[model samples]
Target: MLNTNETRIKYFFILGFPGILPEYYGPVSALLFLFYLAITMGNIFVLVFVKCERSLQKQTYYIFCHLALTDLLFGTVTLPKAISKYWFNDSIISFYSCLVQMFFVHLIGAAHSFILMVMALDRCIAICIPLRYNSLFSNKTVSVLCGISWLVPTMFMVAIMYEILRVPFCNSNIIVQCYCDHMSISNLGCDHVREVKIVALVLAMISLLLPLGFIILSFFVIIAVVLRISSIRGCIKTLSTCTPQLIITCLYYLPRCFYYLANFVGYSFSVPVQIVIVMLYSHIPAAVNPLIYCMQTKDIKEKLKKKLFSWKIDSTTKPMQDKTWQ
Candidate 1:
């Protein structure tokens, strides 16, 4: 319980979720551990698939690769500690460590937003204006966009972190969410937090809303182009390509929308409910994004099927080979 009056705050005790019965902690911990496991394995599959299969190395998948990487990074940064908090009751984090965690949590989130926006643009180019897809989305161009996705968020979050660092936290050290975040950390600071709030609002706009707006605009144009295609097959094909992106977008954005709007509208949710919603949006994408791509994308699915079939063949033939050798 370091006070602001003292030299400086030393640590933060992260209260993973504010409310749960003693009986529920084990179940909750088990569930979150499972979530972390799923997220890790799913994202790894996508990453390995992208790396191993040359056919999956298209510009669009370059964006998907970044998205998968971001999700993996996001989950890795934010989840294990939270899982530890729930399972082992190791909730204390040093102040600076908390800051670092906050940085990556937001950094990766903003990067994911930008990546999704880039994917929308790729989808639009591929589906709406097929001729220019090659010209507009070359590997070099996608690489540049990927760099921007990482760089812009880093810049924005750095600014936000600077502002956060300036806030004096002399109050109680419990963060109400499952992890340390900008809002939770800043709220614990002593003094007027108007500046932090302003910065957060701006960051949210730049990182979340701006990308979402661009995605919406892209979707509208894509729908218009898709409508013009006379053949049902062409329309279905175009729509199918866009569907996974849309699903991923919705998972990432919709919960954020509800949370942000609830706060803005002064709607009060129970702490447990809020925590549940926040945790779902924060980590579920890590699991869902890769699963969606693996199942929905034709190329990735084909590659995965071939790999699985090869594994099955190897497993069945391994015993026969051993017997023959004997």
Candidate 2:
């Protein structure tokens, strides 16, 4: 029988930066607010620009837009509460609300992993088997892959959330991390902690490693195909196309894998260091992914330059036209 009286954790108090002194809170909050703003505006611009511009309506761009959307959701779900926690000292999140946040954090993250894998696959087909790239990755096929990226993660996260909900929380309500994640929340459960942790870990590995494996394989194949090109100019052109995706992939996966491995091995860092690593893996990619694409991809860079030039012309000309009319 369950003891109703013992299960009294109605809310969780998130300790965003337990080690930082009060004087630094404002600065930290300001920095986080900037990151949130950058992530929101950057991803929104990518999504909107891709939707409005027909020239960007290709298989690779479609996957890029999906990645942008995933980054937007991930940042929106986690950053606001963290900003509130530092800015106003408001860290109390209702138990169910924490669960909801945890669910979306993992859901969007898994979706991102899968989307990146799809991007790698797209590149692989384009580079390794150039003749059939269009036929292999048509609009319908891209849509189906993107749909699976989202839908499969949704089902997995739903199951993980169900398992988390069943864990009885009768202990401390303080979450040592910035936001409520699976491991952070499950650690507070009174019982079945090991089982819940194992289940969550297994699901997390499936979401991360499976996609990572495919991405590695795809990149290896791409490299091999690129190597067979005899011309120096051909090699440079082919490798340049993949550089941005490669950078973003490294930024997203490396820190996360390091953190997980450290935790799995029972190695601990100071609170501030740990928090920095977490934020690096979580927020940096979202804030910079669009910028990387805009700067690195020739089509996106040219289109963005054109859009900016037109906007400047309109702003300058509208004032002159109004004055002349008056």
Best by the lDDT measure: 2
**Model 1 scores what on Cα lDDT?**
0.87
Q: Give lDDT tens digits, candidate 2, residues 124-204.
A: 998988899999999789999999999999999888887887888887788889999997899889877888888888888
Displacement of the residue 11 alpha carbon in candidate 2, Å: 0.9
Candidate 1, superposed: residue stretches over 4 Å from native:
2-7, 318-326
Quote the RMSD, in angstroms, for model 2: 2.9
